[model samples]
Target: MTPPDLSVYRLVFRLGDALIRSGASSATTTKALLAVCTRAGLKHPSVSVTLGQLMVSDQPDDGSPPRTRFHEIEPGALDIRWRTRAEEITEHYLLGDVGLEEALEEIEDQVNQKPSHQWWKLVVGYGVLGTGFGLILGGQPLTAIGGALTSMVISFIFRILGHLGAPGIFGYAAGGFVAVLAATALNTAFSLDQVAVCIVAAIAARLAGIASYGAVQDAITGWYISATGRMMEVATSTAGLVAGVAAGIGAVRLLWGPSVQLIETVEADTTHWTASILGAMFVAAGFTLASGGWAVRLLALTGLGGATELVYLFLLEVGTTPFLSITVSTAITGAACVLISRPINLSSNAIMMVSLMPLFPGMLIYQGLLGSLFGLEDSGATLLEALITAFCLSVGGVLGQYLFSEGLWLARRRQFHHTHPGESFSKVMPEEYNSRDIMLPVFSKPFNGSEARPAGRTPKGRPTADA
Candidate 1:
């Protein structure tokens, strides 16, 4: 194998380091490396990447070059080293020969480029999720449909905001709140069902949390470099959603007063095949819109989410305890996300945000707020339940990631053994290959063309080398 060019290797290394710091997954980092190598026109770039492995090749070997290989380490095993490398890359890439301003401008330009046609998928995803939310909240068909529509429109608006460089978290939160308010107002004005309105609003709010880059878990793990900037962009676009919903709700409350009843529970017959198909379509549409342009992928994701919800509903029908059902369902969804995300390039954040929307305790928050406003005693209980639900969701996500990472490590270990039966896998370097044994090659001129002088030495009292 030919030695890689040092300069090009360094460039790739730097970018990889940055990606690592930004909290990218091994798969994402590997893809980014491959992309950089491709952009640099490297030969056989695909073969050069081993997911989660950090290889430093200062100069290539004359014999068969050290092949890229995979080894699994505990998450955060090389965090410090990776962070330093990332910082170096960031410094050189953004602030070296090219001015920082120029580097930033270039980054912005890259971000603005439409890499895929996935916008329709996002619209559908958001819409479908909204419809499901309506069903869960016991909304009527029209209210559910209206809520889904409202959510889709808000999602499109946020996409535009994202293109304009809005922060993601704020954008999502704001979007969600606004969608809720809007749905609430429309339902109230037309004597529509509150259940349906709330469901749609919830779906719209959750869509704000979707991200194409697949960095959701990274954000939770303090992989801020990777997660922070992107999340901020999402937050900003979502703000509009929250604002719109809040406005609608505020307007409704002002006209109707706090005493108005939103939903009356009539014993309606359970929906069957037709209703299920319609519900599924709504979910698919919501996810499609939320996914931006990745409609096919979004459809698959919605199906998964819908299946999860259906299973939970089934368990409920069988008289399984609500708490147990929720716990089991949450675990299943979280684990499924961990297992399937990498193969398809979807981010766990998008999955978690959308899949969990049906269970986010929005009703609790609303009821709590209403109780507090009206000086009701049950407000405290509602607030506590809401907090606990959020906690459970967060905990479920973390547990899923940890389990997945460990599973990857085990799989890699098995592969390594199968490939090299006699070789012992050592986490530490062999004595001969340790950093201390590696010597810096000397570059010096010969003394009078007889013998080369060592670097940093001279015949005279004065030193030949600067330090």
Candidate 2:
């Protein structure tokens, strides 16, 4: 039988890369691929895959003649094929597993082949995410609109930077800092609510760093790939945010006296239920539009955010410190995330971003900065508190993730024991596939009254099945 087309294999590889990057479970990724294949009118497209077996070829180029080969298939049987040059195979063995840099290079090569307009899809998606963030931060409608627009523009600029082969970290930081500074200045000059404007800016900036899928997958499978990427992304974005805020504040300090307060005090709203619900809806709409997510999914995410905020408000009303409130709320959010793992396709990064926004201690940070500009002695204490609050937020989020994952593991063990009576889970749980044995068949082919044939080889001196 003719081997499956190379284009199909390429498509699978691309989809797999995206699924893996997005932190989707293998089972979910497989199911989604099946659905896509079905939609595309493909036949017998169901394929079994072992994780890590689908790695990008890392063989080096050497001056030699290229080689290509085809595999054979029995009538009505599946055909699998692979291609490699001898030099590439040698290099692949020499290099061992390919690193992220190599993987990204491969991805870039493939992406470059597609129409340029495809990049806009990513921009639009991130823009929506930013807008949702703005609405959640209690920005006005216009602020949300502006933030989304600005995020899209920045995304395009970042794309250009990428095309120019700029360092990703520098590009992301520069883009994010510029966006935030611009938004902050616009808000301050026009007497717009700086807190709301900051929220919108922060959301836009933070979207550029969101890593929900990676964090979740890392938490689930003990993989560091997702975890490290997430940490780096968060750290860089935070640096950008700090830099932007500093720049904007510095400009204000220079023009006005250092003693002038950039922020004006406003009365806190006492009405809760109506405003909260409306705000939640606004957040939902913004996110739905930004992420290109389903309305139901957006609503669910908004509900979660609103509910968490209400809990924090309650804790605050009872004299809880902002630090403690954020800590507890984040822990709760993390626990919920672990419990509702599959249903909440929302990334932990995304959820964490939204949940933390309302209680970000931005006001405290601003106050501390203001005090510092005026050289207030007590400013040291305020700044310390501000730093502590930020520390607590990070700690709470990490603690939540750890506790929830551990709890899930324990629960799974308990369930296993309950089902197996005296049996231990260690014995019952299947061992993870090792790289050496992943492609080895799990079941022997059914006896066909013929000797087993090597993959892609036709039995010699026998009547061909096709004949």
Highest lDDT against the true fold, candidate? 1
Error of 1 at 243 (Å): 6.8
lDDT of 1: 0.47
Worst 10 residues of 2 by lDDT: 75-84
In order, candidate lDDTs are 0.47, 0.45
Q: Mark the regions of model 2 whose C-alpha exceeds 4 Å error after superposition.
A: 1-153, 180-232, 244-292, 344-387, 394-411, 418-423, 427-467
Write the residue-wise lDDT of candidate 1 on 1-467 in tens digits.
33334445555554554444334443344434443343233434432222334553321233545434333221111122233233333333321334334434444444355533356655665566676656555566776666677667666766786788765455555565556556666666677646434533454345323331334444554444545544454444434433444455565568667654432222212345345434544454454444342445556666666666676666667887665666666667766766665554444434555565555555565555445655667778876876576556555654565565456545654664575454343212111111111111001111111222233321123332212
lDDT of 2 by residue, 1-467 (tens): 12333443444455454443433333333433333332222333443323233321211124533222222211010000011111122122223344323433454464455432345554665565455445545556666556666667666766787789875556655665556555555556656654435434434334323343334334344444434555455555555544544555566567544554444322223245445434444443444334334455556666666676677667777898777987887678656644443354343434454444444444445445545655656667776785686667655765675576555556655765564455343311121111111111111211111222122211122222212
* TM-score against truth, every candidate: 0.56, 0.52
